[model samples]
Each structure stands twice: as structure tokens, then as C-alpha cells.
Target: MEQRSVGDIEGPWIEPEFDSNLIRRCRENWAVSIGQVANGVLATFIRQRVGLSIVVPEAKCRIEARYDDDSEMYDGELAAALADLS
Candidate 1:
């Protein structure tokens, strides 16, 4: 089997082809949730068969709030949890 890093793939889910517009819109706004049900199964397979470790980094806001549109930001809890896991 070919070795793969976690970053080697796109986001941890697959969507229907027709949902491209929705996917694009979510990516544009950064409101997409991480992972999916299939991702969990895939991760289990990778762990058992490939013995690879996954590292999920912290998500932070890149753009500052220009108005009322971009104020919501990551509080670093996810990042800190990942760090602690490592």
C-alpha cells in the first residue's frame, strides 16, 4: 500500500457530484465542518492496516473581522486538544 500523510488528501469527506456548488460555497466561507462518517471508518482502516498517525492542527481565523461578517473565530480549543494528544 502506498503511504499517505493526512495532508496528502483533501478534506475528510466525499460528497455527491451535484453538491459541488454547496461544497464550493462552504469552502469559500470556511464554514465547512471537519470530517464525516466515512472519514471515521477510513481512519480506522488506516490505523489497523497502515499504522499511520493522524495529526489535526488547530483552526484559526485568517481574515480579521471587517464588519459583522467575520467575527466568529476559533478559540484554539481544538488545537490545544490535538497538541495534548500528541
Candidate 2:
């Protein structure tokens, strides 16, 4: 697969100047979300033998929330989920 930065994908829509800080923050949040989803899938697999069909919708919801500019909600959900895991 070809590699692409978040800025390359989102830069066009961003008004005026490209914000490197926004790109960096987006990249960081994306990674964190992916990691959380991966961990959830692994745990479900080990415990219930469930697969991606179960996890993908949940991930989609989270991603949609982030794209909807509701990242504070996403972050709170993520933090609460992590707290549950701990």
C-alpha cells in the first residue's frame, strides 16, 4: 500500500494556510483510536472468538464522531473505555 500523510488527504479542505499543528494532532488521535480498536478486537477474539464484523461498526461510530468535530466526546469515550480496561 502507498503511504499518505493526513495533511495530504485533508490539506485541500483546510482554509487559508495549512496547519501543521492540526495535522500532527489529527495523526496522533488517529493512531490512538486505531490502537484502541486493535486492543478491543484482540481481547474480544481471545475471550469470545468474535471477529471484525463486531468491532468494525463500533470503530466506525468512533471515527464518525471524530470527523463530526465531536472529538471531545470521542476522547471522553476513549478515556472511559480505557479506564474500564484498567
Candidate 3:
């Protein structure tokens, strides 16, 4: 069986034009929005469990993609569900 790579993107992945800490802080908030985690490391854990071995990071596995498989639509549906709160 072939060990297919998932969500692996090319790197040095960081841009010198950006502040690494600031960028990391911004991305880290993603998990907080879902109440899924408290930090970048926890984001990876939630994403791995949620996506199984199917979805992963562009690097050595940290954080979920902005859009995972069916995630966008799922998010949309979730938004619709929450729209009632408006």
C-alpha cells in the first residue's frame, strides 16, 4: 500500500515579510472560535481526530486547514443553524 501524503505543502512555509509570532497568534485563534482548543498544539489534536488520517497540515502536522473536506459547507450549515440566534 502506498503511504499517500495529505495536506503536505512546500515550505520554509514562513514569509520573512510577516511576523511569525503575530501570524501564529492569529492562526491559533481558530480553535478558540470552535471552543475546541486553547493553543496551536491542541488545534492539531482536534484536527487529527476530526479528520482522521485524511486531513493534515502543510507541515509536520499542526492546525487544521481553513477548509477541510466538506468543512466549508459544513460551516455554512452551521452558520445557518446559528443564524437563528441573530
Candidate 4:
């Protein structure tokens, strides 16, 4: 696994310039989403064990990349999703 910096362009990964605060918020939100999903899965499993039917919904992990109005930022496949939302 290659480590990528904030704006490294040498590798295949998209290294768009972004606000550090945006990155931090995205990371925090990602962690919370993961924790919530794990908790839900655990609860559902435990309920099933007690003969209570339960269905755990799937979660989609989305890391949104945003840029200031003056800056241009685009990730290959991600561009479409971003554009669609806009």
C-alpha cells in the first residue's frame, strides 16, 4: 500500500487540493458512519439469535471531495457523482 500525500500527483490516485478542515471533517464522519454500521450489525445479529427477525441495512461509504469556488478539483470516476449532485 503506497502512502499518498495531500497533493501528490505521481501515483494513480487523485490528489486534488482540498481544505485540511474538509479532510478532517470527512474523516470524522467516516469513522462515525462505520461505528454506527457496526453497532447496527451487532444488534441485528443478537436479535436474530433470540428468534427476533431483523434486517440490517447496507451502508454506503462516501468520501465527498469539495473545493473552494476559486479552485478546481476533480477525481476521475468521482467527478460524475459530484456533478450529478451539483
lDDT scores of the candidates, listed in order: 0.31, 0.37, 0.32, 0.28
Over 20-55, each residue of candidate 2 has an lDDT whose tens digit, in order, gives: 654444434332333343333323322332233333
Q: After superposition, how far is residue 3 of candidate 3 from its true place, in Å?
A: 9.8
* Candidate 3, run of 10 with poorest lDDT: 2-11
TM-score, candidate 3, is 0.19
lDDT of 4 by residue, 1-86 (tens): 11222122222233347756544433333323222323233232223221111211211122232322221233332234323333
Candidate 4 stretches with Cα past 4 Å from truth are 1-19, 34-86
Using lDDT, give the best candidate's number. 2
What residue pairs are clashing in model 1?
Answer: none
Is candidate 1 or 2 superior in TM-score? Answer: 2
* Number of the top-ranking candidate, with TM-score as the measure: 2
Name the better of 3 and 4 by lDDT.
Answer: 3
TM-score of each: 0.20, 0.22, 0.19, 0.20
Off by over 4 Å in 3: 1-8, 20-39, 42-86
Error of 1 at 18 (Å): 41
| Candidate 1 lDDT by residue in tens digits, 1-86 | 22343334444434456765434433332222223212332322232232223323112121122112222233433333334444
Q: For residues 1-86, what per-residue lDDT tens digits would candidate 3 score against the true structure?
A: 11322222121323346676545643443223223322332234333343223222222121222333343233343333223233
Position 15, candidate 2: lDDT = 49
Distance from true position, residue 77, model 3, in Å?
A: 18
Q: Could you tell me the TM-score of candidate 1?
A: 0.20
